[model samples]
Target: MCGGHSRGHFGHHLPMGIPVSVPVEERRSSPVDVLNERLARGEITIEEYQRMRSVLDDQYRTKHSPHIRKPTTA
Candidate 1:
């Protein structure tokens, strides 16, 4: 009974299927646009906007090149 159960479980262990394509929706607003809007509405200070923009820029760059670090020598 144990052997039969093991054989049943091990059958067809390899995955079989064609990959399905999924559509990804693009963001409606760019990071720059979102930051500008927040600044215009007084929701963020100039310093906050600058910081957020820098952070977002770094994030975008890192996303595109995760293995590469930003230059620190200046």
Candidate 2:
């Protein structure tokens, strides 16, 4: 008899599962952090920050909040 027979569907080795790889650029800079850094570095003025934040909010709603997106939407 086959004593060391493996179990489960061919590739289902780990019951807890494994992680999928993701791109680096897609995983950087949270909204608040981006705004804060820009503000701190004077890259954006207070008013501009506020305005960008509003747009960013809309972006966060539509997209997955990946830090940047196409400005002109059809």
Best by TM-score: 1
Off by over 4 Å in 2: 1-27, 63-74
lDDT of 2: 0.76
- Looking at model 1, the pairs that clash are none
Residue by residue across 1-74, what tens digits does model 1's lDDT show?
46345656643444668444455455477879989999999999999999999999899989999999987997
Model 2 residue 57 CA deviation in Å: 0.5
Q: Model 2, 1-74: lDDT tens per residue?
A: 13465664454553566765569777787987889899999999999999999887887766885666558877
CA lDDT of each prediction against the hidden true structure: 0.81, 0.76
Collision pairs in model 2: none
Residue 7 in model 2: lDDT: 65
Q: Which 10-residue window in model 2 sums to the lowest lDDT?
A: 1-10
